[model samples]
Target: MQNLPTSWSTPVGALTATGIGGVAMAVAALAVTADPAGRFLIGLAALGLLVVTALGLRQRPRLAIRDGNRGIVLQRLGGRLDVDRTELRRVRIVRYPRLGRRVPMLEIDVRPPGADDDRLLVFGRWDLGTDPTNVFDALNARGLVPPDPHRTPDR
Candidate 1:
């Protein structure tokens, strides 16, 4: 239960994923137990999945309260994610919870090539990039990013 936070999805995300992963392992174990010969195949597949997810888990962002590059080039182990200041299309604190009626999610989606619509950067809601409710503050302080049209607030 302490594996999913309404404000940030870091520690909770990891724990929640692990929990589900354990459950999946148990299911596979059961399937293998019922079929002796097929057990090897399922076991091999599970091992492969575990290896992949473990590598991806290494890319979890740091929660340190400091200013980092406004836009970053993300990658997993060896794969690259398309993200740069120029590719940044929008940044906002999106709400995923309601007062006693819905669950919550803290995320900032980034759009990209062919991926016209997809979540880009997502950390926690209360966890901002910089001072106050201004994520731009983080970027500005970094002094490594340029003004992005998508980051402009609707005034």
Candidate 2:
């Protein structure tokens, strides 16, 4: 696997806040619930929150993209995916509605060397850091692939 730069993960402050809030709510719920059924439900909720908190910490977003001469390797939560440079059909910067705001994504459509259908790879800010647009610039820098006409160039 080609080494790639690591991107930012979930900020520590956010994770800390979640843990503290979940603990506080769990303690208060346990103390205040008088009925056994209500207490059990509250306990379950507390457990769920704790589980989510743990997952947030463990499965924090980590992205790495390796540009091998022949293809690009994307490493994320699931695993590594290889995208052959020759197979890439279209590359564009797209905006997606996220958290009530527009987030940029690098959308790559690949036909994968004789495949009838195309596979779409979407890379968001989380996957490529604050400016995914740089990816397009980098690919263009290689001087092999021409600029995509369908998408406007980033100014």
Candidate 3:
């Protein structure tokens, strides 16, 4: 059997490239565009791209599985969440149709210590910089989550 990675994260290079592109676009829009409305629209789009890049950079190394199967750490906008092995209730891949293609997301259900209800955390391909199915398989290999009998192996 092949060994799988224990951690998954968004590519920093991709985000940095996007930020640079956004800056170039913004500059070009302001310097070359003669129409005020066109410049405003282009600038708005560039700003949005920069904002996304900033957020992505802020949450570097988005998800990681701790050593000894202790838990998984998730970094978000404001802070990080640590979910122990005991807290993890379920992990599965969910697929949804988008633009005539199926997009997969990894859904982790966890009940934190002293928490009465379970919270569902979803990570998309963009978040992991890879297919969620691959992450799911890695989690399964590490025995962090139980195997789903209903899920087909073809994925």
What TM-score, computed on C-alpha atoms, does each candidate reach?
Answer: 0.38, 0.56, 0.88
lDDT of 2 at 30: 76
* Backbone-clash count (model 1): 3
Scanning candidate 1 in windows of ten residues, the lowest lDDT window is 1-10
Candidate 3, 1-155: lDDT as tens digits: 24677777778888988899899889977886578988898898899889989988888678888887788889999799888888988898889899999899899988988989999999998899889988887887788886556766664
The C-alpha stretches of model 2 lying farther than 4 A from their native spots are 1-68, 76-78, 97-101, 143-146
Candidate order (lDDT) = 3, 2, 1
Candidate 3 clash pair list: none
Candidate topping TM-score = 3
Cα lDDT of model 2 by residue, 9-123, tens digit: 4455666776877787689677975687777777777777776567556644433333345555655456555666777688777888889998778777878777899888776
What is the TM-score (0 to 1) of candidate 1? 0.38
Pick the winner on lDDT between candidates 1 and 3: 3
Off by over 4 Å in 3: 1-3, 147-155
lDDT against true structure, model 2: 0.62
